[model samples]
Target: MIRFDNVSVTYGDAAAPAISGVDLTVPEGELVLLVGPSGVGKSTLLGAVSGLVPHFTGGTLRGRVTVGGRDTRTHKPRELADLVGTVGQDPLAHFVTDTVEDELAYGMESLGLAPEVMRRRVEDTLDLLGLAELRDRPIATLSGGQQQRVAIGSVLTPHPRVLVLDEPTSALDPAAAEEVLAVLQRLVHDLGTTVLMAEHRLERVVQYADQVVLLPGPGVAPVVGEPAEVMAASPVYPPVVGLGRLAGWDPLPLSVRDARRRAPGIRERLAGLSPTRTGPEEGDRGADRASVPDGSSGTDRSSATDRPSGRRTFMPLRGASGGRERGSAQAELPEHLAVTTRLGVRRGRAEALRGVGITVGAGETVALMGRNGAGKSTLLSAFVGMVEPASGSVLVGGLTPHRTSPRELVRQVGLVPQEPRDLLYADTVAAECAAADADAGAEPGSCRALVGELLPGVRDATHPRDLSEGQRLALALAVVLTGRPPLLLLDEPTRGLDYAAKARLVVVLQGLARKGHGIVLATHDVELAAELAHRVVILADGEIVADGPTADVVVSSPAFAPQVAKILAPQPWLTVSEVREALR
Candidate 1:
């Protein structure tokens, strides 16, 4: 259905082509998974199939590309809209209508379909994607994951022969991601549709793909093969593949079931050891932090001016074993890093949050997780002063967040939002870093240094828009970290990051925690929560349903557990790193 003959794409007067010397064919009615590191032209390759590379993106095309035998060069995106359905990374950009129902119907309307056909497809799509409950909600008011589903539902309703998706499940929770992937699988199996998807979260979609196309790097020829063959040596892989490689499994497992079938021997090997935790234990407000190497800085040197006066510092309370005493008497509580008492937030007629209360101490990491529209993002917004509570209070460093001045609040707290582009407006990366330094009162090149660490090889002359999604997210994180805030809030921090980039981020965040910074991140990446969070907080229907230690909370829940935890059930292991530590 899709063919690339000697394809190469170069934008403007670049030193090297974004993708080069690629000759590939994707059979009809098959799902092809595109795997690669960030900025390796995976998006560019997908764009070629949709005719957006040279036509809409204003790039030079060196070779012919065709979809359903229709030459993409001759057929612009609008010309091929009937045959191809493309959903880009940013869903808000893809939206054309205000409400979910309207957005889903708009595509079929553009195609000039019959009214009855459009109505039927719209209803089927809403039910298929579990968007029936949100059909009347405005697109702008929905959460990030909800917007993503709406964008997908809009495309699915059109029922095009070919589907091209970029990071389709990046914003979704685990269950929602599974539902979306299952829908795609059904499309391939039952409807004979061709799907070409590029995603960074390989853990979610790898097992469903029939063929794997790997762009090894920029200017490198593509490698096409079976999923296991490609994943064995792929630079970026999920935790299952990592575990398979670590344990010398002959054929790498792609899913938890396969991994578990091969895990008995290794489980026996690790029977003598316990999985290692990366942060303070749960229910211990003053526990000694687990030692983690400093990947970002040397020590906690936050400015006293950024903190409120006359607040007591919380000391690390420990027992004789350097661990928190399980049943010891609790000490008088000191001023917390953040506190929310009976918090309530309303969006339109919906209660986004209600009767919510949580606290964060110095040097703690917490993860907020839930299904789409479950109020995780709203709670993060409350911490960053983006939304004012309708009832109760939100305090950071002892001052109310909604009442605090923007200038002072930035120093006390910082947020990297789900849409990283919202925090960027500068023309070049260097300009953005310079402006961040000035705004945060940091040393010259402070933001640039952080950018280099998070996303290396990003040039000063490159526009922020030119960077890949993961690179843009890293740049936004650097801008926020430049402020050296005591409290950090991240909404879907790993939306576009691959395994290696995420590990680098984990190390950097660990370093920040060691420096007495408190972090709260809202994410659906269960692997991230397992690796970085001391505690996990689950939200459902705008209220906290469960909150406890990371292992205790995620290991028992089938939907929220990571691949490692699921593979080695009854062992309480949550990550490949923990398993590796125990094995060693």
Candidate 2:
């Protein structure tokens, strides 16, 4: 239903077009997944489908893009609202209403639909997206994942024939992502709707796509084919596909279940080896050492100990028992880097966090995982003093976060919020870095150097808003790290990162953990958790439900398990690199 004929989009005064000479057709009733690295114009391509590229984004379109045989050149986004619904990466920006129910119904009201029709569609969307409980919640009070679902539901309520989504599941937990994907599947199969989705988390959605559109960077024509055909040469891919490539499987598996069917021989090959752990050893921090089951690689596991019983374990670093200097490097920081005791936070009349207690130790990486509206974001905010606890206390570097001054808080704790845009304000990358250095009293080039390490080749002259989602995130991360906070909090750090970018991030975070920095990341990316997190904390309805070593927490929970863990199950392996290391 969507067609791009020799399409090319270029912003004002750029050396190369964002995308060029792309001729593609997405059939009606099919879900087409747009895959690419960070800045290959996936968003631009999606915008063309919804007529937002040249219309609202102020870009020049070389060729025509059509939806349902109507040229987008002639139809503005508002005019095509009934035919095509678009949801951008930032959900909060899409909302024009205050509450969940109102946001969902806003689109239909704009379309001037019958009140009864709008109400019925709103209820259906709420149930479909599992947003019924959150229907009355304010959009601002809800978690990032909840806001994403609401954004999608608001668009879906319009009952458009075509849906264009940008990172639809980036903020959602695995189960919630599956629910959203399933809803899309139903729309495609039952209602003959067309879905054009662009996502960085290929592991979650690759298996469900009817076709794949691969954007291989600038100046290269886009490649469209069946999922497997495209993934073979596609630069970015899920862990399962990488495993299939390593094992020399005939057709790369898109999902864990498919990979498992062909895993027996490979399991035999890796029987006697141990998988590699991506981070530092637990080192007497009461780290849980759970064993893999028998079916996993046929490996014996008598040496593994029983799982620990507390919600979490905190091991104090060498100097942490007696408060040390606050500006110490990662190595000199104390083990109890940050602590929360019976934390309770409320927004208006709604309680966002209740009796929440957690600890981050020096040289430790903790991942906070949960369903939408589970208070993960709220918990992160408490650490940075963005939200004050109504009861109990939060201490970062031996000082109360809420009571600390902004200047002092920067040195103790730093947070890269859910929306990277919130932290970025300067016009150019160089200016942002300069401002960050001044604020943190760091070396002149420190922020720029960090940005290079996180995202290489990013020009200093580029506007922060002009950068792609992943690049903007890297820049924001750099700005935050300029303060050199002992406690680092990242909410959905891997939102738009490609596999390669994510790999670099894993290395960076691992280095920080080894140097004694304490890290707490609120994320829905299970693969990321498997790579960098030493401990996994699962939140649910404002309370901690499951907290343990990464292996125990993610391996046991099907929804949270990584691709390799699922395929190599019965072994507890969490990543493709882990499996490869075991074989070697």
Give lDDT tens digits, candidate 2, residues 1-584: 88989999999888889999999999999999999998889999999999888899987899989899889999998989999999998887798988999999988888899999998999899999999988997777677788899999999998999999999999888888999999999999999999999999999899999999999987689999999999999999999899999999988999878999999988888777777564545443222121100011000101111124210111111111122233335344677989999999987787878888898988789999998778887788788666778998998888786676554555566677776876777799999887766555555787787788778878888999999888899888777666556678888999988998898778767756665668899999999999889999999888899988999999999889998888987876888888877776
Best by lDDT: 1
**Model 2 per-residue lDDT at 417:** 71
Single out the weakest 10-residue window by summed lDDT for candidate 2: 292-301
Candidate 1: what lDDT? 0.82
Q: Candidate 1, residue 447: CA error in Å?
A: 1.4
TM-scores for the candidates? 0.91, 0.91
The 10-residue segment of model 1 with minimum total lDDT is: 312-321
lDDT tens readout by residue for model 1, 102-175:
99999899999999999999999989999999999777778888899999999999899999999999999999
lDDT of each: 0.82, 0.81
RMSD of 1: 7.8
Model 2 regions more than 4 Å off: 278-332
